[model samples]
Target chain A: MVSKPPPDATRRSEKSRRAIYAAALSLVGEVGYPRTTVEGIAARAGVGKQTIYRWWPSKADVLLEAFLDLSRQAAQEAGQEPYAIPDTGDLAADLKAVLRLTVDQLLDPRFEAPSRALAAEGLVNEPLGREFVTKLLEPQLQLYVDRLRAAQEAGEVRAGVDCRIALELFVSPLAQRWLQHTGPISYDYTDTLVEYALHGIASQPPRSA
Target chain B: MVSKPPPDATRRSEKSRRAIYAAALSLVGEVGYPRTTVEGIAARAGVGKQTIYRWWPSKADVLLEAFLDLSRQAAQEAGQEPYAIPDTGDLAADLKAVLRLTVDQLLDPRFEAPSRALAAEGLVNEPLGREFVTKLLEPQLQLYVDRLRAAQEAGEVRAGVDCRIALELFVSPLAQRWLQHTGPISYDYTDTLVEYALHGIASQPPRSA
Candidate 1:
């Protein structure tokens, strides 16, 4: 997650926020959600508990925002927009490019361990699960939805297609594969998903015989 | 969950095992996986903890086997064999039938909370995730692989298709929807997934221009 202020924010606050973000992610990964506490994050960040409580309401909120900050920072470092997937006009190419970046993120040790911890915790924690889904995951998914809607308008996708559900044809495979270790992630795999998704799966043409 | 066989011989012991299965399932749902214990299950089932331990190793194992048993019983109750997705030779109908059953299971209160707990644990615990996937999940997934391979032989699916990835097109979407609350799940959704998967998303037909 990124600091909310503009790039010109005080170096000290930026450093402290970064420290808190790192502390929040690392501690949760190490001890898990149950044992992870606000005090622990503050201690590890070299700040008072008030610093965290002042910023976020709960441990879940802190960690959620921390992940968002991490993602934004990671995207910026990659020279990509923090939120949007590349359009590139060609849907398949754009999808492949975005999924490749996703592969890198999923395989990154810094991102991997902490993400897995939170995701696992979300499986059982309903409120946290919904919060993470709403604040963090769904917004990212909506980006794909936007791109697909663009494709549909461009006539690359059939007019009758449900952009929301259609996006999942490819998107959810990557998600499940990563979340469940159901399979390996690769450019070839993602590229195939994008290709398979844009066209109909039946031997016939799209939307008709 | 099924009734366990008596240690050596006894009609009444079989009844106790069934009671234990029902108790374990109900307890895990009501109290959740973490709060559920051997003692709680024993007291609820009106059996000694030793009776449970004599049959299963750990609480996780108990819940896991209990789920497996429940699935079998549910399938049998539906008048079908457990683990076999009917190959009535209409691939789409078979998949839809199985997925509908999955929807029913995912929605079942007896299955919901405990399954969520196990799934949440699986996200972080690779060993447990792999164990359950191998024992409880992969076998189910393989049925789709087999069906796809059969479709390939019959010219229902493209000969070039990878059954593993092909199945994910339909399977992962339904899973992502269920696990993450990404979208609404319905027979319509599953039917659409099967159609999308068997064909693909390209603008052109798979066979030729």
Candidate 2:
């Protein structure tokens, strides 16, 4: 168990944390990762450098936490539970609904710029990339895995299929389009992805095979 | 038709071009996009800065052509035609074979460093990303589209399905695994992607619907 801070002190800490997150995200978005500095984030956040260091050890930590917070807030704003994919038993519909939310998050201006900056940095910075993926992305991916496992047990997915790789069929296409600007993204597009992933592009015979 | 240069002059130009490509790729791979310069590439290539400027207008142009040349050389060395996916009337086999080659290319040290450097830069640099995609990636993707179109005509694919999007069900998964290091890539992995893509991930019904 941990001791709680008094109300006023807690409020002050919360305010500082929010400011720091906003500053870190915006600064990284504007300047790109290499140019973003802790001092700069501190200055922009209007908090002393010590205040930031006391909470987070490195700029990467601050940014990572900031991103996590932002995602949680985005999920809340979208009326989504941040931790789990909804399981309605109708797998395609559930997957489509959740992916539509992802489409919204990806398109949201607040999320887009900073996420792109960080993703670009991650491409070359392997340690940071692995850290962010392990902490942030892999967890989110695991939600899909859990959902897929449920799907497998329900006899929706094939028994031998790796749920991890199976999830990528629908997920990575949207990611590639968004990251590489390979194509336009929309609810319709993602819906098509889910459908294609479920039923496949091959011509189905008149009867179930 | 264009006039041919004298044989000796052409040979000298070819040598210079190869040297410039090597210099550009290695320089970008080592120092990254922002720091790679015409002067630096020329110096490394043992050619005058004028030679580089005369051929390519900017560092981006140089890098783009260098990548295109490298890809062509890689494909040729792998015994693949530079522009087309093979069609042996077996869609799954052809896609799997092409993807296996991609797995090899992705793992090759000669391709990995420079491609990652450029791909990282492309993530942040929108215009360069679009330009490279248009000149290099889109053409490659079009080959898949064409193959899928052929598959559609042969009754292997559903006629109404979008070939471009269908191709992503396999291609983007491999790409994401390679780009994000989300998973290990291998021939077996790609072969599985072909299988899952050709058939859906969902358990097939006793008869096709």
Candidate 3:
């Protein structure tokens, strides 16, 4: 059976939700996780404290959902389907394209400061770290797994390779670089990662004479 | 001219130095970077405040040098040279051995807590992140570069590959898994990373008829 659509009240609630998300992100970026408060978010969002509390259990929950929403909006703005990686039947090309988009997201001023703040806290806070990973990171990583598994079925990837681990070959380098300031990130760098990940670093053995 | 030998006073100074390092590590691990103070370390080590100040300019300096000293001791205990990765002529075997040792070190209790504390701080603290990278991480990574360069000379690794970027294929996955609690880190996982990084995930093509 079809469910009824959300009422006009739901539209007002959606507006309030967007305001709360923007406020939460900006506040966290400015004051960091420790100093960011529910009251502060409520005031900045121009909503009652109970309104925020009614929707989210804590500031962390608010921030998490805010980030998820931000990512969805970014994907949409980039003309990409949210929650899905494109498979153009070219695994390398598909992977490189997705990673280039990720590089843009990572470098985005709107995304960077707040993300770094949250990630910094997560590094020290084990429960929060696990929560963010479960809700935010693991799902994104699973998209890569799906793409890799499809490639395996297509004879592009080795059958025995673990898709989860294989995805890390390209994904983790970019993550480490962003998180640790270990290296410069660019479209070229991500494209090179995809290329190197697909082609062996060792020279191809010579054909039989 | 030959340098003068240290007097009996030098032995006393060395003892105090070790005590200070242990105190610094344990304090930071317990309370985290922000709350850890030079005064706390001095009290814990049973040294005067002036003793800590005379030796270290700030808590950060103390922590950095303490970590460096801890790493040296760990390397010595493992019966490995402090500043070198062993080259056994077989690149995969050598890299695997070093990584296994790294896995152990990452899991070690003494190394885990203080390291996490420092790394957590480094994530949001840019200057500190750059300092630790320059002092600690970049040097270790350079060792891999040197090793990979040797492999290139011996025709094991393909020429025209950037060893710095190549090493990240294996290294960053483990770093991400450990830093983010993304997955279970194990010998098997690291071994798979090395195999994938060397030969890649793509299936081998058929030889020419």
Candidate 4:
């Protein structure tokens, strides 16, 4: 249904797109979401305002794509396959590994400010918050859902457990600590979360890890 | 050194205090943290600005105390002992009971808006965020710690478990869902969280409960 662009034109467009993403991320971090404008993004990226409009419907769309791109970059930097959790036949180990990487990503200075700004705005701004969750957060969470389902199939997780809520046992604690400064986050902390989540905090340990 | 006020004056001040707290809660909920002001709260509450300043040093202080008072009120309404989880020799039942009350509190229209506004502000404002955790959140979380410790002593929870982080297994999930709109909040959901926290999501169920 669509014609492909020439390779040279595509390259040029890609360059502009990356620049726009960078500009959007930094601008949102510095000014916060309420003050971030499409024109400001276009000016910072050195693209025409019309060029931004050509790709994204609104500033929210631009910001969302920018954050999506950021997550992709962070995943690549960590040597993780984007949008996927490793399944090495050991659910606890795999979950722990992924959570440790999350700990790193959360503490990354480049990721922290913009994320906080966007999240803060999202709290009061319901439409934007839902969009952020739908476009950005939920996709990442789906990866965990996939991983847990696999574990269920392999008999690592109980059949009756809700994978969606199951993932939160480990994930949300780390999130709370990072988001609210509730506690210190470390590889050890995340490792504990995984262990606690998989085996539980009850007296009888379910199984040897 | 504290001087006792006359009983009649104290009664008048108590009424003014309740009015001020109500004003602070509603103003923050409607206008959000940045736009909310002491002057506006005083105007809405029908108190002089000096009356507010005499009690609380800042808007944040006013909001914090307002939240604290609100929590106490909610607990009383729920027929719960304020700030304490019950010990019925069944950790799971006790946790579920408290979390169900929390679920009710989170979904309350009176609690929701002001909480989201203050929490959103806290996400970016580090000092305010830290103060909120220290004064408001940690105190609440510590009650969980206390309950968890009691369970540990009762040999219900693992002795090796860190009660602080262990509480997060159930608590943070509910918190994240409410804060981010990631999922539905219900007594069923919270009860499931307690079950998952106690017995875990692994293949082998740990305990009979």
Candidate 5:
């Protein structure tokens, strides 16, 4: 359906949209997703329920958008595009820079509780788990895949390596530590991970003569 | 108050114990931790509620014992010594063999449902999560730490590396994949992880020379 919008109307819609996203994030973080209601989001947002309904089908949809918005803002704050990983022909540096930023985000109090709440819910709730991975997590992972692929082209990685799985060597440890509280995380640790992942930890290169 | 046991009572206690463990795992798997009750476990286990109280003091203790029992049986079937990582000196082969077995365990239908239920609960429930990590998980992970320590002593790994964190290179990826369903796991995938972990992925060897 094609709809026409005047400039003033569009600006008003954007303002309401920001309010809804903020309200949704705060409510979910405070009350959690299962208990969060559209009425609560509308009231906290200082908007009518119809306004939220016009933009989002449910609280789930609203929260998802709220999370996506948070992620984009985080990416911008990190001085990188939300969906791109820089490939300067130095894979280690790029990966380290990105992972360091991730460590910061994971440690940030603003991001911690809400994301954990959402992720916890996602575990018991399969559809939401898949949705978060597909929309939020997988896309960030794809940026790594793309950078690795470019590295493959540059002869910086083994020719036959699968970039998708390759990225996990460094990525998954941080993920498990954060999710399970298995260990501490730091930029130095992540940098070492990138070094170990890119080179080989066997004390000798696998492809060496 | 100290209680004394009767002669044939030992057999009765054993039978009730097995039933209790079974009931706890199945009930938690079906209904999750927050909903699984002491009364429900007792009823399902076909024992007097006081029988459970006579042994463990709480529902959490019941579930923890249930998981420990499950892990013990699985380890025995895998020909693994419970709570030990076999130190065959060849770290790569040892880790790969253990992880391949783990791949089987993670995919086992009997283990999958209950593990997921517990893990999902762990994500939101701090006390249960910490208890599982301390009693169940850390002990297993420490076996790897011991093996890694042995490797370091043998001059196979760098001196400064932390055995605990180093094990995560091979371990956590598989875990994240299993817990989050991020990717399919296989023998080759785990083998690759062990290789990447030991030598590292950096294109150059250590400058420590």
Candidate 6:
């Protein structure tokens, strides 16, 4: 087994890591993905370039981890668990609750600029886009899939529905509005999405209802 | 009333306009929005820079109109009316058919590159993003709104449903999948989205059902 580092070394390392993450986020937000450099992050963080390379592979990796850390901090600050969607036996309520938090995260000044910048680069940079989606986005989407699957087993959702696609009915609308500036986003809007997704917009209710 | 241009002059102008549009789309696709210049577009189109300025006040206007023209041409090629979503009275079928055509358009090689480029720029450029949403994206979304409104009048959609948000239940899923590379887009996928939006994913059907 590897030995634990000395306490002083551990504290120092944690400080440097947080600084690097902050620097990475800010640098990427300011200059965008293409122009953001490892050297720039290191300089901003007051850390050596070797320290960054020792911990992360590249600028993309650095930014990805930075975003991940930022999200965790945001979730913690809001008293939310980062990984699980609460299965409170009311799917619509749970979804709306989470999405409202997402709206908060999306609108946070700390998250907005860096996310927009990275997302812009990701559009044209296919490899980076795929990497971020696979590592970051898909995992988050899987949480919804899991929630929907639980709802399905509980008979809260149609058994025939694909949970993955079902989740998108509410999720993607918020995403599009935020990313494309297609409309205003709020608790009211997201609450409406959840209600619509659960009950649909059809005049005739399902036979089960 | 304004005098008509000489027939030859009209023909010449049309040719120049087509060349300019082609140049603008390809250049933006290659170099992205910030790097693309009116000067470069005119040079590539074999027209004087003044020729472009005579028609469009800015590069953004030229690109916007170019995209509009491209969409009209694509719809025509597909034998679709450019502005209308068919109201066949079977709302689901009509929606599925239109979404299938949209899937084809999204996957079209000609539309993909330039659209991705412009969308990437729009993510970070608020004014440009708002302009495109107002002039291009919103009009297309309004077609769905109109169709949903008709359905409401026909007793096909619930009267209380917000048609704008209702359309996003289907439309935004497709948009997010395409924009983010989060999922594969296909006719089947779009058809499923339409079904889900119309009927919802909930277990109990509404009282009407």
lDDT of 3: 0.89
lDDT of 5 by residue, B100-163 (tens): 9899988898788778888877766767888888887888898888988888888776677767
Which lDDT values do the candidates have, in the order given? Answer: 0.81, 0.90, 0.89, 0.91, 0.82, 0.93
lDDT of 4 by residue, A113-171 (tens): 89999999988999999989988999899999999999999998988889999999999
Error of 5 at A167 (Å): 1.2
Candidate 2 ranges beyond 4 A from true positions? A204-209, B204-209
Supply DockQ values for each candidate.
0.59, 0.63, 0.62, 0.68, 0.55, 0.84
- Measured against the true structure, the TM-scores of the candidates, in listed sequence, are 0.91, 0.97, 0.95, 0.96, 0.93, 0.98
Which segments of candidate 1 are over 4 A away from where they belong? A1-9, A206-209, B1-10, B30-36, B206-209
Best by lDDT: 6
Model 6 interface Cα RMSD in Å: 1.1
- Order by lDDT, highest first: 6, 4, 2, 3, 5, 1
Choose 4 or 5, whichever is better by TM-score: 4
Give the TM-score (0 to 1) of chain B in model 1.
0.87
Per-residue accuracy of model 5 over A115-188 as CA lDDT, tens digit each: 87787777767788888888888888998999988887886776667778778889999988888777789998
**Model 2: docking quality category:** medium
- Candidate 4: give the clashing pairs: none
TM-score of chain B of 3: 0.94
- Which 10 consecutive residues of model 2 chain A have the lowest summed lDDT? A200-209
lDDT of each residue in A100-173, candidate 1, tens digit only = 88888988888988998888777767778788999999899899889988887887766666777888988899
Which stretches in model 4 have alpha-carbon errors above 4 Å? A205-209, B1-3, B204-209
Clash list (residue pairs), candidate 2: A207-B207, A207-B208, A208-B206, A208-B207, A208-B208, A209-B206, A209-B207, A209-B208
TM-score of predicted structure 2: 0.97
If you assessed candidate 6 against the hidden native complex, which CAPRI class would it receive?
high
Cα-based lDDT at residue A41, candidate 3: 98
| Residue B102, model 1, lDDT | 79
